[model samples]
Target chain A: MKQRERLIEALLALSAGISVLTTGGIIVMLAVEAAHFFRQVPLGTFLTDTQWTPLFADKHFGILPLVSGTLLTTGVAIAVALPLGLIIAIYLNEYATVGFRNVIKPLLEVLAAVPTVVYGFFALTVVTPFLQRLIPGMAGFNALSAGSVMGIMILPLVSSLSEDALTAVPRSLREASYALGATRLQTAMRVVVPAASSGITVSVILAISRAVGETMIVAIAAGQEPRLTANPLVPVETITTYIVQVSSGDVAYGTLEYDTIFAAGITLFVLTLVLNNVGYWFRQKFREQYE
Target chain B: MSNMTRNRLLDGAFRAVGLLATLLGLLLLAVFLLDILRTGLSRLSWQFLSALPSRFPERAGIYTALLGTVWIMVLTALIAVPVGLAAGVYLEEYGRKSRWSALLEINITNLAGVPSVIYGLLGLNIFVRFLRMGSSVLAASCTLALLILPILIVATREAIRAVPKTLREASFALGATRWQTIWYQVLPASMGAFLRELFWPCRGRWAKRPRCSCWGCWPTCRLRQKAPWTSFRRCPFKYSTGFRAPSRHSESTPPPLLLCCCSLRLG
Candidate 1:
């Protein structure tokens, strides 16, 4: 029995170490590859170059275009998602009857489960055309459609998470508001929403990070022209899409083009990592304060 | 307008906006599903399920992708379940709230947020290049196992946490060892919820990338050789358009959950 217990403990410890191992591997691999790339291209040039024509004859390695694309798409996505998601959460939590909440909640789950690639297809075939018809300047394949679909893709993430946050507010708070004769809307918007703001902020930040890291939707629908512009109506290439593009090509390992893939991945990783850490900090703060 | 009337009107308008937001999300989903079904449901005959992918769109099928998905899900489960459950068990039961464990907790949570494509990238580096596994089924499965690890570990911890403390106390009082107590008592009690949490998120991932073949490398190989018009027509359609059943399945789960919660509350 003693021997068996020791063996089990060893196995459990090894299992726990695997995640730590994976993170270590990613950091080391990305660092080595980034170091190799920076040896060829200066870090200043990579960051400040306005043109992102890496594969072109001139081979300008400016990442401004990629960053712009990611930002534009993320900005568009958040604009659509945050308000809609917050309202959906408020509706489910405060106004809806139990029956209504049950139905709407599952619908949101299904909405959340719908694949990004499908949204890619929807943007490509359905949303883009519909938008072009409605707005004269809308490109057939533009960031607007992709961003809109991504918004829909992330809608449930924001709503469900924000709803969880809202639900965690003490019931006594709601009862107190009611005893003071506040309307349901007043209680939800002023009392409950303020109480859940930290969680809501975390959700929004997480969603923004997810949007920045999104690939397939942008790859398939958002046009691949790397342009250093902030316009959502135009084609743009994001860091993620750039990675996907390079990976699909036969860029030999260890080549400058190949190393750029790692550089792009590193940037995307760092961007999301910052957002995630901030979101994680807020989540921890909220959990501790509430509990 | 009178003060009370104006206040009531504002409340009604906000309520309308909330209801509209809920309906908008549902409406978009309904349209997405209807669009997929209209285009792809008719293509789901037995021949579509049985035939190999062909050059012609009319003849191509999802036979490879379907089998590949099954292979991935099964293989990923084989690798992920034991490790994830053990990690969760160790963290919750054996491990204490030390600095190391706290660091581990943050690492796991951060890993959970890393993009799936980054996992794809890492899989390419480690499993394919360093380990020389290539982009075969094993490599992709390993990547997916790593991808699902955070979810599985977190879920297992939550499930184990939910198991009443009294159950473990009873087993210990009976002179059962810790391993024996977990295996016989806590494990059995939490299996259903744990499985749901583990598999549901993985299913969500699969739903996210239904088009990815046994390993992602295979599909990329096929695409690199040619324009891949047939793949554009088939793989995405098969994976994304084929989710109607699961949506219906998700719909069935909540009603019963509501029923149980109501019963418990009443009792």
Candidate 2:
């Protein structure tokens, strides 16, 4: 019995070690490649240059355009998702009758479960065409439609997480507000929402990280032009889309073009790491304070 | 405006807006499904399933991608399940709380949110490039196994944590050893719940992808473009959430299930 116990413990510890090892591997892989890329292009030029014409004969490797492109899509996504998601979450938690709530719950799951690629396909083939007719000078492959669909895609993330947060607020607080003659909307908006503020902020930030990392929608719909403009109607390329483009075609090992992607990957990895960890921090803070 | 009449009007307006907010999401989903079904259903015949992929969409099939997905899923499950279980049991039951254990806990949580495409990049570097697996089924399987491990570990830990502590003490009183108690009592009790939890995120990985990324969606799509919506059915966890939640609620927290069952039934 003693021998058997030791073996089981060893196996469990071994798997736990593997998890740690994988995390180390991710950091090391991205770091080493990115370091090599920076050797080819100076950090100053990469960060400060305005033009991102890497594939052209006059190759200027400015990362600003890509950064701007990413911000454009994510900016539009946050604009759409932040309001819609918060409102829906409020409606789901504070307003709906049980029967109405039940119907909406599965609909939320259905909306959430639709594949990102399916969203990409729909955005590219259906929505883009429709938008072109409605909005003048809206490029067939533009950031606006892609970002709009991505907003819809991450709607559940924001709404569901916010709902979870709102739901976590103790009933006593709501009762206390009601006893003070507060209306339901007033109680939810002023009392419960303020109480769940940290959690709601975390959800919104996590949604931002998700948008930053999203690839397929931007890859399929957003045109491959690495442009500096923030205009929604024009075509733009994002960091993830650039990675997809590079990986799809062979940039032979150890080349400058190959190195650029790892550099971009590092940037994306860092940005999302900061955002996601901040969200995780807020969640931890909220739980520690409340639970 | 009279306070009573104005209050009633505002309440009615709020209800209408809430219902509309809910309906808009449903309308978009309805259109997406309708479009996919209309475009892809005629191509989902047995011939499409059985025939090899071809250059022309008319003559194309999903056999290769289907087989690839099945093969990868089995391999990933085989690799991930045992490792996840062992890590969960160790972390939850055995590992004492310390700085090290706390770091591991936080790492696992963060790993759960790392993008799937990043995992694909890691797979490209580690399995296909360094290991020289050459983008084969085995490399993809390993990539997916790593991708899903954190999710499974989290689920297993949650399930084990959900199991009542009193049950373990009873087993100890009955003179059962730790291994025997876990194997005989805990495993039997939590296995159904654990399996359901473990399966959902694995399905989520493939849910967003029909043609697995390690395999590349473009090559297969170029070979056969017809079966766009074929992936919808294979992912069971989406709809199964509604069915699975209420049952598990009763098992874990019988008292709360009375209150939780209604909300759990839909989502």
Candidate 3:
């Protein structure tokens, strides 16, 4: 009996260790390939140069254009997601009846479950045309439509996380505010929201990280022009989009052009890692205060 | 009295704005579904379900793609469910507060935040290149299994944690081993939550297209056609190929609509 128990424990421990292995695999795989890439391209050129045409003969390898494109779309996405998500979260947590909340919460989850590919198609086929009608000179593939649709995609992330934070704010705080003659609006805005502010900030940062790393939506709808422009009306290429584009093609392994993706992958990995750690830290601090 | 009226008016206005914001999400979903239904309903026939890819848009069918999707789903479930459940069982039932387990906990949380695209890169390097899986369905399934592991593990841990301690104590009193107690008492008690948790990863693997596409899962359809279970490489969202031709909207629109309906039902 003791021997069997030891065997089972060993098996279960190995299963749990696979997660650690996966993290190690990601770091090592990215680091080794990115090392090969950095050998040829100077770190300065990779960060500072304004162009990113590695596929071309001239071989300029600046990552700024892609960074700008990523920032531009992320800026648009956060703009659309932040206010709308917060408002919806506020409505659901503070105002809605229990029955209404029950119905709406699952529906919001369904929205999140819908594939990013479908959203990419929607951004391409539906949103771009709608925007073109509204604003002349909107390119067929522009950042505005892609970013807006992406905002809607990540909206659930924001709303749900913020709602969880708001729900975690103790009910006694609200009663105290009411006891002090504060209106419902004043209590929700001043008391609950302030109390949940760190949690909300974590959600927004995590949502931004998601937006930065989103692939198909930007790849399909945001055009593949690696230009250093912030105008949403024009086309731009992001880091994930560039990776997808390269992977789809028949780029030979071990080539500098192929290695560019790993270089780009490391950049994306570092960025999302920093955002996630920050969010995790904030959540830890917030939980300590409450629990 | 005026101050009270002003406060009431502002509260009412905020309520109105909040309601509108909440409704906007539902509205977007409705519009998207309506558009898909209007375009795809007529083309969704038995013929569309049974046919294979053809150069002619009118003759193109989603049979091969559907087969590939089934293969991916079955294989991913086979690989991910067991490992994830085991990890969950260990963490909830057996893990002590050691530094190693603490590190395991933190690693899983951070892995949850790593982007899906990065997972694609990992698969490209590890499975496709190093292991020489040749971008087969097995490779794609393995990548997706890894991709969904963090989510499944977290869900399993929550479900297992929710199992009442009294049941375990009862089993222990009966002279059961730790594994037996978990298998018979805790797992059965938490089975409902476990099944519900299974739904998310299953739907997630179904909806995920880009990562598989990055692994070159599509091109193999044209190259290798031997076994649907082993080397099949058609992505369900290859409907995007049909979408390229605006006039063939009927051929392409139904598959994704069908995919959406099936996934929603699964959810």
Candidate 4:
């Protein structure tokens, strides 16, 4: 019996050990490669410079363009996804019958299950073609098309999270709004949306983080130009796309060119980590209030 | 028109807009399934399933990718299940109501939200580079195992927490040790739920493999006709998730047809 008890304890310890090791090892590798990158290119050059031509002969290493491109695509994606996602959540929670919600929810989940690569293909084949007719000279691989498809790709995240948030808002709140002679839309837009603001905000932030870290879509659809422009129609590149471009190239090990990918990765990692923490904090706070 | 007429018009417009939004969101799913079926189904004969990715796209079967996915999935399940179950046990039974446990609880919830691609980068650095696993299937599988680790942990914890405390007290009163009480009484009571919690994420993780399209969806589709027991009895935990055993049933297979239509559109 003592031996059996010891075995269980050992298993518990073992799991914790594995989790910590995995986290630790990832951080260490990122740090090691980043250290190598910083040694070759000064920290100021990587962070503050505007141009990011690593593959060229004159190898400029300012990361602003990549950062802006990531922000731009994410910005456009949020603009498209958030309002639609929120409205869908509102409709599902406040207006739809239980039967309707059940059907819609699983379908939305199926949307989430579709791989990001498929979205890239959709952007390339379907979205880009549609957009090119509206905006002339919209490149085959423009950020706008990629951003729209990405918005669709992460729609489930926003809608599902916001729906969960909206569902958590007490029924009494909606009843009170209705008792005040508010319309259904008013009850949704004013009372429920405000009540669920924190959760919805966290969901939006989480979506932004996803857009920022997304690799496959932007890699395939968003062009590889590291321009700092905010033009949505023209081709633009993201940090993740830049990383893919560099990695896909024939850079030898330990070169500044190779190290640039790690530098970009660190930037991507830090942004996502911060956003994830913020999202988590909101979810916790909101959940605590309701509980 | 009267005010009543105007109000009805407004409601109709709102409903129309809502329906349109829902359809818009669901369209890609339809398009995806339609696209895959249009392209892949005619070509997905037995020959295709049994073959591997060839240099020629025409001859490219998903055999290696499928086997690799299965191999990775089996390993991920073996590695994640026991550890996740144990962690769940710890959080649910041993540490319930503790402040530290609550904190860990929140952390796990947040951990599950991190993007899959970030997990890829994490895998590239941690498993492939640091551990020298290269870009082999093993590294990818381990990466995914860690990716879904938090989900399994949270689900199992929820399952164990759902077990009645009365069961625990009963065992303790009968002179059972804490571990014995948990293992024999609490766990067995929650066993069905635990299996379910483990299976969903495991299935998802397997499907998330870079190479393979999921087969779980296939069994849910056309294959259930021959072996009605295949869906539920094949995997006990899957039964609770509304996967009715194919055996001992009527001659209908409506759900799989619907599922196939859905998968066809969404693929």
Candidate 5:
């Protein structure tokens, strides 16, 4: 009996350890491949160079264009998601009836659950045309439409997280605000919002991280032109998009060109890791205060 | 009285904006569904369902793609569920408050946040190249299994944690081993919550198409070469480029594109 118990424990522990192995694998694979890439192209050029055209004969290996593209789209997505998500969260937590909140919350989550490829198609076919009419100079494949659709894709994530935060705020705080003759909006905006600020901040940061990592929508809608421009009206290629562009083609394995994806992948991995850790730190601090 | 009226108006205005904000998600969903239905509803005939994808847009159907998706789904579930469940059980039932366990917990959370495309990179490197799986369905399924493992582990932990402490204690007093206690008492008790939590990962894996593309599981490639007859080794690909193709073949592509949307809704 003791031996069987020990055997089962070992098996279960091995299964649990797979997650650790996965992380190690990601780190090692990216590092090894990226080391190969850096040996070919200097790290300074990878960092400081403005252009990111490796496939072309000119062969610039700068990562700035991809980084800028990522920043711009992520900025646009956050701009759209932060306010809208907060508003929706405020409405659901403070104003809506329980039944309405219950129904609408799940429906909103369906927005997130929809395949991003579908959103990419929507951005390309539906949104770009609409934006073109509204903004005459808008390119067929521009950051604005893709970023907007991605914002909508990420909205549920923000709203749901923010809503949980709002719900966590003590009831006494709201009642106290009401006793001070505060209106519903004033109570929601001032009392609950302030109290839940940390959670909301965590959500926004996490959403930004998600937006930064978003691939399909940007790949399909935002043209694969790696220009160092912040203009939402023009085409740009994000890091993920660049990775996709390389991977989908028949690039021979172990080549410097193929190694660029890993280099790019590590850059992406680091960026999101920082953001996630920040969010984690914020949540830990917030939990200490509340719990 | 005038100040009160002004505040009331501001409150009402904010309320209106908030309501509109809430409705925005529903509004977009409505538009997407309506557009897909309007364009693709007519093309849902049996021929469209059964025919192989052809160069001629009129003859293209989602038969191979659908079969591929089902294959991927089953395989991914087969791999992910057991491992995820075991991991969750270990964390909740067996893990003591040690530094190692804490590190493990944080690692899982971080893994969950790593982008799906990065997982694609990992899949391409480890599964496709290292293991020589050659972009087959097994490689894609293994990749997705890893992708969704964190989510499943978290869900399983939550479900197992929700199982009352008393149940475990009772099982222990009855002279059951820890494994038996977990398997018979805790797992059965937590089954409902566990199943509910399982739905999201299932839906997510079903909807996950981009990773397939990353694995080089293009539908055209899969269709040209007959996949191995064995269930485990089949080449399943999601038709991600179908949306892009319609731009050139506008006349014949909308139906299949719309069909994908409809099927997505059903899934």
Candidate 6:
């Protein structure tokens, strides 16, 4: 009996070890290469420089331009996805009949399962052509097109999370609001939405993190022009696009140019780590329980 | 009367917009599938599927990528399935009420949310660099294994928990050992549910066509069927074109068992 228990325990330990080893290995490797990067290029230069011409002799490595571009596209994606996702979530969770939601939810999930590269293709083939007709100089590969496609890609995530949060709000609260002669919209907006506010906020943050970390869409659609401009019409480079570009190019692994990818990766890693930490805290702290 | 009619108009407008949004989402999917079909149909011959990637633009195919994807998924399922089940069983049976187990459960949930590219970084370090796998199929497979392990364990645990506890009590009363009771009573009873859970997370990955197969790969020609052309040949019917897949497999190896496994999982 003791031997059997010991065996079970050993198996559990082995599984946990796999998880830890995989996650830890990533952090350690990034840190090693990123440290090497900092040694070659000053941390101040990497963090503060506005220009990102790393290959040239007078290389300015301030990552702000790339960071700003990422933020701008991410900002647009969230702005578009959030309200639209909320409306869909409200329609499904608050008002829709079971049959309607059954059809809509799976359709949305299938969209979510479609790869990011597919979304990039949609942006290139569909969104870009449409946008170019409307805006005279809208470049073929610009943040606006990328962000719109990304917004569509992330719609399911935001809606699903928000729906879960909204559903978890006690039915009794909505009932009480209705009992007081509140309209369906009024009850949902006043009673349920506030109660689920923290969960909804966390959902938005997680969706933003997903947008920030997405690689293939930005790599394929957003051109690698790291200009520090907020205008979405112009081509701009993101940190993720930069990572994909640097890795896919023919640079030798140990070269300074190659190490720059690691550095940019580290920066993206730190940002996502912080977002994940905050999102984790919100989820743990605000998980609503009902009898 | 006016206010009521106005309210009705507003409600109708809102509902229309709601329905339109839903249709728009569905239409996007339809358009995507239509485009893939439209482009890929002309190239959907047996030779296109069987041929290898070639620098000669006309001779390229997804043969290597399809093979690589199969290899990776098969190895991933092999590595992940047993470990995930055991860990899940341990958590459900032995440590169900333990605080550490709960903490580990929460950690796994969060880990599943981490981006897949992060898994690429992890694979680069642990599998490629540390283990010297050299960016081969093994590294990619193990990386994906780690990515799906947490999800598998969670699902497995849920399945185990859903098993009835009365059977365990009944077996224990009949002098069965705890391990024996769990093995014979709990595991067998929950086997179907376990399989259901095991396959769900992986369905998305398997069904997805690997992007490496499509990007920058040269196009290969598909068979173009020629209509039967003859004057005074057909009595009353018009000729039509109907292309068919090449009846050949000698040049190309058959897809591995893993593709079959994916179909099984989907089933």
Best by TM-score: 3
Clashing pairs in 4: B32-B265, B32-B267, B33-B264, B33-B265, B33-B266, B33-B267, B34-B265, B228-B246, B228-B247, B229-B247
TM-score of chain B of each: 0.76, 0.73, 0.85, 0.68, 0.81, 0.71
Tens digits of per-residue lDDT, candidate 2, B1-267, equal: 987677667767776776687777677767766766555554456776665545454565545555655665577778888898888888888786977788888788667566665666777788767987765666666777787677667777767877899999999999998888888888778887786664332223211111112212111111111122232211111111111233332111111111122122322
lDDT of each: 0.73, 0.69, 0.80, 0.66, 0.78, 0.66
Best by DockQ: 3
Clashes of 1: 0
lDDT of 6 at B55: 45
Ranked by lDDT, the better of candidates 2 and 4 is 2
Candidate 1 local distance difference test against the native: 0.73
Please give the distance, in angstroms, between residue A177's alpha carbon in candidate 5 and its true position after superposition. 0.9
List each candidate's DockQ score. 0.29, 0.19, 0.45, 0.15, 0.43, 0.14
Candidate 5 residue runs with Cα over 4 Å from true position = B200-238, B247-267
**lDDT of model 5, residue B58:** 71
Candidate 4 achieves a global lDDT of 0.66
- Model 2 iRMSD vs. native: 8.7
Where does the lowest 10-residue lDDT sum fall in candidate 3 chain B?
Answer: B206-215
Error of 1 at A254 (Å): 1.3
| Candidate 1 stretches greater than 4 Å from native | A286-291, B199-267
Q: What is the C-alpha RMSD of each candidate to the true structure, in Å?
A: 7.3, 9.4, 3.8, 9.6, 4.1, 10.1
- After TM-score superposition, what is the CA distance of residue B160 in candidate 6 from its true location, in Å? 2.4
* Residue A196 lDDT, candidate 3, scale 0-100: 91
Error of 6 at A39 (Å): 2.2
Top candidate on lDDT is 3
After TM-score superposition, the amount by which residue A259's alpha carbon in candidate 6 deviates from its true location, in angstroms, is 2.2
TM-scores across all candidates?
0.88, 0.86, 0.93, 0.82, 0.92, 0.83
Residue A5 lDDT, candidate 1, scale 0-100: 95
